[model samples]
Target: MKFDFCTLLASSLQICYDACCTFRIWNLQVSILIFFSLFLFF
Candidate 1:
């Protein structure tokens, strides 16, 4: 029972970590695009 719980927790944590990394990369791309657009506008 304990081993199963640990496995579940680890998997969930890994999934969360992956999601965060993906989100961070997307956020960075969006920020860069916006920055360039504003820079060009001015």
Candidate 2:
């Protein structure tokens, strides 16, 4: 039972880490898009 709980905790931590990385990448893409649009308009 303890081992299963530990495994579950480890998986949850991994998921949270992956989510944070994905968010960072998405934010970078959004900023790049905005910058390019502004440049094109100007």
Candidate 3:
């Protein structure tokens, strides 16, 4: 029972970590796009 709980916790943490990484990458892409658009406009 304890092992199962530990496994569940570990998996959940890993999922959260992956989501954070994906979000960071997406945010970076958006920032780069905006930067390039503004640079081009000027």
Candidate 4:
């Protein structure tokens, strides 16, 4: 039972970490797109 609980906790932590990484990448891509659009407009 303890082992299962540990595994569950580890998986949850991994998922949270992955989500944060994806969010950061998404934000970076959005910012880059906006910068390019502004540059083209001007």
lDDT to native, each model? 0.58, 0.57, 0.58, 0.57
Q: How well is each residue in 1-42 modelled by candidate 3, as lDDT tens digits?
A: 254645655765565566567786665555555556546644
TM-scores of the candidates are: 0.47, 0.46, 0.47, 0.46
The residue pairs found clashing in candidate 3 are none
**Stretches of candidate 3 above 4 Å error?**
1-3, 24-42
Clashes of each: 0, 0, 0, 0
Q: Write model 1 residue lDDT over 1-42, tens digit each, in one string.
A: 254645655765565566567786655555555556546644
**Model 1 ranges off by over 4 Å:** 1-3, 24-42
- Please give the RMSD of candidate 3 to the true structure: 15.8
| Alpha-carbon RMSD to native, per candidate | 15.5, 15.9, 15.8, 16.0
Looking at model 2, the pairs that clash are none
24 Cα displacement, candidate 2 (Å): 4.9
Which regions of candidate 4 are displaced past 4 Å?
A: 1-3, 24-42
In model 1, what lDDT does residue 40 have?
69
lDDT of 4 by residue, 1-42 (tens): 254645655755565566557786665555555556546644
